[model samples]
Target: MSTVYDCSRPQERKDGLAAAASAVRSGQLVVIPTDTVYGIGSDAFSLSAVHSLLAAKGRGPDMPVGVLVGSWSTIDGLVLSVPYQARQLIEAFWPGDLSIVLRHAPSLAWDLGHTKGTVMVRMPLHPVAIELLRETGPMAVSSANRSGQPPASTVDEAREQLGDSVRVYLDGGPSGDPVPSTIVDLTGDEPILLREGAVSIEAVSEALGGVQVGRPR
Candidate 1:
């Protein structure tokens, strides 16, 4: 990757944001800051770009990547189903550390690792991430590291693994408390706790008013 963009620097941040967004629009990958951890982001609508992201991370096509959005409206548009309980979770934990896996809209022509019909969507709270999402519409983002390696919490770490695979790096410093977002599957009969991370299962259950959810194995 080229020079790491110091996102804390105002002018550099503005320029970096523009460059990053442009790169994404052109189906290029960029290391970006998210509320939970650093992510390798690309245009979600671009199948080739998504493949590039998977290839860069040394990830298999079977394991799908998650899509990051700027607002609830965008989430609603990209997904076909959004149950009442899912809405509740979004309201409670969105723009924070929560990921919702919902059935993807069949009308949309995008492949996220041949995910069948589901896509994980998140709305991050970080300023840099939000701005980029706002400009890019939706980005397919995964942890900025090789598939088996521990997730990178800083731009330097991401660059170390990703190297020239990514075109640009938005350095937001070490991601504070690099826990991943909680993942919940809403396509099943009931909400299933896929992975508990920043948000606890207790919080999710409470948000749903004691709805039963499958525990992580």
Candidate 2:
């Protein structure tokens, strides 16, 4: 059986965070609210949990999952070497709605799918998400919906799609609008805009001192 916790209540929020953290640690999936949309997440280092997350979404390794971190410093440990531009972007738009793709540290023992030695990472601006992430460390997360369906904006919608696949649902109320985080790929020589979302391309360029953002592929 699965559980849903109304995070609006103080006690439920505390309990939900505990349950969600436990679920992640045990290689089970959980749904949590992010600044962008509801996300289904599992322990980033657990291959079985990652497989379950992908299967629940009807997705494949080709469409790799992204990782959500709790703090600004977390990215430093996830990537091979945080580039200067990545640092600038983190300083300018982190804990907001920017997701950056960078080369993962080869020493790490996790697989987020056919990421080709790279990983997309973000630091969300939701307190519940941050609280849960702090307890669980980095998590493999993706939109809480089937591969071709709309992203979930509430825990109810997420539960409807993911069902018993997710062990816990942390309801942080309605997620307002479902704007996705802007994804910028910094794995190449020049920064590339993989997806233009909540954050604008111009803002990204401005943050990097007018460096041209490459067109989406």
The per-prediction CA RMSD against the true structure, in angstroms, equals 1.1, 0.7
For TM-score, the strongest prediction is 2
| Error of model 2, residue 217, in angstroms | 4.7
Deviation of model 1 at 196, angstroms: 0.7
Q: Give the alpha carbon lDDT tens digit for every residue of 120-200 in model 1.
A: 999998999999999989999999999999899999999999999898899998898889999999988889999999999
lDDT, candidates in the order shown:
0.91, 0.95
Query: Candidate 2 residues 127-148, lDDT tens each?
Result: 9999999999999999999999
Q: Which pairs of residues collide in model 1?
A: none
Looking at model 2, report the run of 10 residues with the lowest lDDT sum. Answer: 172-181
